[model samples]
Target: MRLRNHEGTPVDPVPFLVVVGLTFMFVLSFGPLYGQALGAGLELSVGVSFALFLAVAFGSYYWQVWTARPETVGVVPASVRAVRLFYLMLVLAVLMIGLAIPLML
Candidate 1:
């Protein structure tokens, strides 16, 4: 998707993820993976983890969109951009999860 800001600069499409993610999860069962994730703490940590997952997932999507192909990705080749966003989300997810370690401890 070609994302344009009010000023018309191409923008990273992370915010688009909420609609896409929810729609996807709605159609497909979030399943045991979701259960296992939420089973922890069941209170504070659950919320945190959910938020973290959204952050990471969005990172994956835009990253993928960016890196796929210029025709597919828009503005530029998508694979490289997509890969970058993926790694950005990965690193952020790791960092966020790492932050959670202290709470778990």
Candidate 2:
């Protein structure tokens, strides 16, 4: 499957994956805690990892658009803005839930 940028442009997966891959690698390198959790018992860790990866990817896409499309600022339709805000909140909630699950476990 291919990844789309915030503006629905088909982003080059090579560059996007490079950014996300390095981020995931950096995360796993922090300590053995994640590894132990994954190996020993906590299956939620996998979900958390995937959720984080998605969050980072979307965030990066938005950041790219924000920087590259300065002229499009203030031209967004209200409905589109609302939809974006809803998705942003939903993703944030998912991120929080993912983190909370690890702590709860």
* Candidate with the greatest TM-score versus the true structure: 2
- Each candidate: how many clashes? 11, 0
Candidate 1: regions farther than 4 A off: 1-73
Can you write out model 2's per-residue Cα lDDT over 15-79, one digit (the tens) per residue? Answer: 45666775576444322356455574345555566667778877765665323444454798999
lDDT of 1 by residue, 4-104 (tens): 54445565565556546743453233322344465644454545555666666666655544443333345656787889879977986686566456445
lDDT of each: 0.54, 0.60
TM-score of 1: 0.33
- Position 82, candidate 2: lDDT: 92
* Native-to-model Cα distance after best TM-score fit, residue 17 in candidate 1, in Å: 5.9
Give candidate 1's whole-model lDDT: 0.54
Candidate 2, position 58, lDDT: 71
